[model samples]
Target: MKVAFTAPMKPLDHPVPSGDRTMGRLIVRALELAGHKVEVASTFRSWRAEGGEDVTREVKKLALTHAQEISEQWIERGDVPDVFLTYHLYHKAPDWIGPYLCAKFNIPYVVVEASRAPKRQSGNWALGFNAADAALAQADQVVALTNSDAQCLSQVLSKDVLTVLPPFLEEARFEISQSVTKGSADGTIRLLCAGMMRAGDKQFSYMVLAAALKQIADLPWRLTIAGDGPARAEIEPLFDRKRTEFIGLIPWQEMPRLYRSHEIFVWPAIREAFGFVFLEAQSCGLPVVGGRVFGVPDIVEEGTSGLLSDEGDASALAQNLMSLIKNPHKRENMAAAAVENIRKNHSLEAGARGLDKVLHAALERHQFKRKAHGGR
Candidate 1:
């Protein structure tokens, strides 16, 4: 089967592999690994995606152009393929072209990792919201990343066919990079919280963690944050730059060595769809310390790879960090478990193969429906 893929946050040509791009790339890899061909049908490769007057106009224009280009590409290639698989087409920007082509061809339209924040009505968000809601309503199948996401998507699509698959990621990138300067385990602990500094992703709570940890000055620990976003300006001044290492936007391929050097991975997200970083950190043999936000409990095995604290509770997150900081034996045990969990559950081979199963299932379903309709 040839799968046409689309994503909202990922640029079709962006060289850097950030979270959304990585997911898009991994999903394409997964389809290919299953012996199926994939075509990235539609994409918006602009940094001006954030809400504004001009961005709204640009997104609409881009969506229209991309849709036409994809339709032409699929047509010129002789066949439209068996299915169309899209990822993360949310309110910021939806692959308006994908739905158009699918509707015209009367083919299966599949959406993965779609969500809606209905209240966002200003500027580009309104257009994104409208596009996403329409796609959710039109999709033949929706692959939800978590149970909660499935539930949320159901509210819009009113469909019960959403698959509740564990969020899959390529673990190879999280391997110990030789570039990261290794730190001696000389009584001091290292902690890291990685993710975009988007509001409500827990960058706000980092201020609280800083305040809490700064109180324990004699603890001999280093906390480094690796990410950048609009919220950085507001959040950066709050943390002590002298002690904390703020490495802005580290490449995805080199994050593993950074994880190996750290003792604990901290993510106190107020709300998270699924923190893929938890899997990355654990893949690099680092224990996690994260908030029990939406879908996070499903990702982090508490007391094994990491401890899941209550969402937004910086005090509790700080305490959990301290416990791991002092308990060397426990941290070491958890680190081993973290790596093993990745090997068993989140490896690239396993994830890509699982993806194969889903694509095959979708193709079979399409065939079955076709047979019932006399190959209509």
Candidate 2:
């Protein structure tokens, strides 16, 4: 399989530590692991955070430019892609290249994490929303990362087209080489949180975490935060300087060590699409504490691998943290379970196998459809 993979929300090589970028890289790697050749089709981003007339016009212009550039490259090389795969399609960032190029080449087209909502058709992001809808309708297979995403897309997608592929992490990168041991009785609980300090939901999550920590100020705990973004100045003030140490974006290679050293991973995963960081931490033998809403439940097994509190509830978040802090036995059990759960369900190998199945099915459908249309 020669797969032309793309992430229109943000390019795979975009110099940012975003979830979309991470997922794009993972998906490409997964396809390669499944014995397929993959190439980055384009790094042209079509993301518009605040969509209005100017943004809409810019997105439209970019779409045209992307189509032309990709088409010219295909003609020059004289090798059309066997399959076109896109990641993270939503109202704010819709794909316009994959559908066009796949149609032109008469190849299979698939979308990972494609979402649609009819209510968004009339709003500031009306143009983006409509464009996303158009792309979703054209996709031969739509891979949903969670049941919620599947349910929402089922209304617009056929039952056979909708499938669930949970958020995953590179298990090899985070595997513990030695026997797992519980945190020592040093009496100082160490909590770790890693994420880009961006605005919107990211900032809101940081704010909620800071409030939760404030509620448990008397607890003997230290926090290490690893990430940097545009909102660092604003986000830094939210945490108490004495208890929290901001590392300002550690390298990806160093993340496994960071998680291994920590006892608990805390992040108020507000509106997260099954945060990969949670899986990364778990894979490194660290339990998690996160919100109960959205995709967190899909990743973190409540009461086994970690604990979850109500979304945006500072008190409940603090309480959940306190439970883990006071109960070392429970924390130790959860830590072991965390690693096990990730190995069994959310490993990169698992994701690659699942993708391989989907790709085979999509190819068969594409062949059948083309034959039915007189091999056009």
Q: Pick the candidate with the highest TM-score.
A: 2
The TM-scores of all predictions, comma-separated, are 0.85, 0.95
lDDT (tens digit, per residue) of candidate 1 on 7-60: 766754676545566667777776777788887765654234477656766766
lDDT (0-100) at residue 260 of candidate 1? 76
**How many pairs collide in each candidate, listed in order?**
1, 0
Task: Score candidate 2 by TM-score against the native.
Answer: 0.95
- How many clashing residue pairs are found in candidate 2? 0
Measured on C-alpha atoms, candidate 2 has an lDDT of 0.87
Record all residue pairs in model 1 with backbone atoms less than 3 Å apart, i.e. clashing. Answer: 177-257
- What lDDT score belongs to each candidate, Candidate 1 first? 0.73, 0.87
